[model samples]
Target: MSNEQPPSEQPPPDTASDRLLADMLGLFNRYERETAAARASQGDTNPYDLAPYEDVHGVTNEYEAARDSDDPRALDQFLDNLADGFHLEDVRALRMATAAVQAAMGRIALAARERGMSPDRIAAETGYTASRITQFIREEKQRRAAGDQ
Candidate 1:
């Protein structure tokens, strides 16, 4: 008798093994997707890429020179250049308001001194040097005198 079986009498499919294989494939695909997302979240990790260092407008010669220089002041100048180039109106307004507040404080100090508050007492109360307090009072008096003329 022949040992071969007829094509119509095939063995049953291994359903358990097929399900396990399908599950493994799904897990592998999920792992690949997660890995790709992690890399994307990390952004460009290459140190050789200068794209991040370049300004949005363009790479200026001043920035390049500052970056290449050994002087510490060059970095300060570079920062100043960047700040001057990108003028935030809100920051400018805040700086102006700060100046106005300082002037007002100086005037108030002068008024306090005019009300018989000693320079030493004013300095101790305001956390300023006695000489600085005296200077502020003198300046205020001079300003008043100038206005009276």
Candidate 2:
């Protein structure tokens, strides 16, 4: 038999794509943990209360799917749903999660910019429009500038 190892047995190569995927998963895990903590701190008795549904049954699975996906928009959409109502805890959690995820995306975009990636390129990779990518970079720069003052 050949000495070649199977894909499952082999270690993943340290490619940019792999790094991005790892970062995504890390961010998702943080989102889940933080959201749960926020719920607990707000005295939410039900763990599935943040699931964005009236019927809490089986919604944890749907929430997990939304939070643990490779697509960042899944989490964004989930947060959107959460923020759609007038619940104070849900709004606060959504705001916190949105800020955290946006900060991470900003850092990634800035790193790409530092590496000479154009807005169009970053947008293509991030699934955002070039104009929006440019706007995000501008906003991040302003935030840093404000922090320097």
Cα lDDT for residue 71, candidate 1: 94
| Model 2 worst lDDT window (10 residues) | 50-59
* Global CA lDDT computed for model 1: 0.72
**Which residue pairs clash in candidate 1?**
none
lDDT tens digits by residue: candidate 2, 65-117:
88899998998887676557448876577678768977777777877998999
User: What does the lDDT read for residue 3 in candidate 2?
Assistant: 90
- Candidate 2 lands at a TM-score of 0.35
Q: Global lDDT of each model? A: 0.72, 0.76
